[model samples]
Target: MLKVECKKWNQSLEILREEALQAEHPRTRERLMALYEICGGTNATLVGKKTGRNPQTIRSGYIDTMNRV
Candidate 1:
């Protein structure tokens, strides 16, 4: 399982999921969904395959979302 690495924030996966649902920008929402899957222990490569995001892009989105929270 991949652990969330942020020391300043410990947001629950559910909160990320909900935020993804509420995000105003389509791109932001899409990235947030990828971020949610990553936090749930889904492999970045698998999320990339399923969502059509590059693996590196998925990881980057995960990192960006973690910092935002």
Candidate 2:
């Protein structure tokens, strides 16, 4: 079970949503959407399915990058 500490990123779900929509790059939008959904209490499995990625990739890929940021 992974938790998205949105506060640590200085962003809210709304902020992530806006950024996702404003993002010019497809991959950037995808990543922001993932964070937005996860922060809004979506399951990684469902998000992954929506994004056509593996659940574990959803967990490890952006989550790991989010951690670094």
Report backbone clashes per prediction: 0, 0
lDDT by residue for model 2 (1-69), tens = 676778997888899999999999999999999989998889888999999999998899887779777
- Each model's lDDT comes to 0.74, 0.89
Off by over 4 Å in 1: 1-3, 64-69
lDDT of 1 by residue, 1-69 (tens): 344553456667887789899999998898778777877888888988998878777766566556666
Q: Residue 23, candidate 1: how far off, in angstroms?
A: 0.5
Residue 11 of model 1: what lDDT? 61
In model 2, the runs with Cα more than 4 Å from the true position are: none
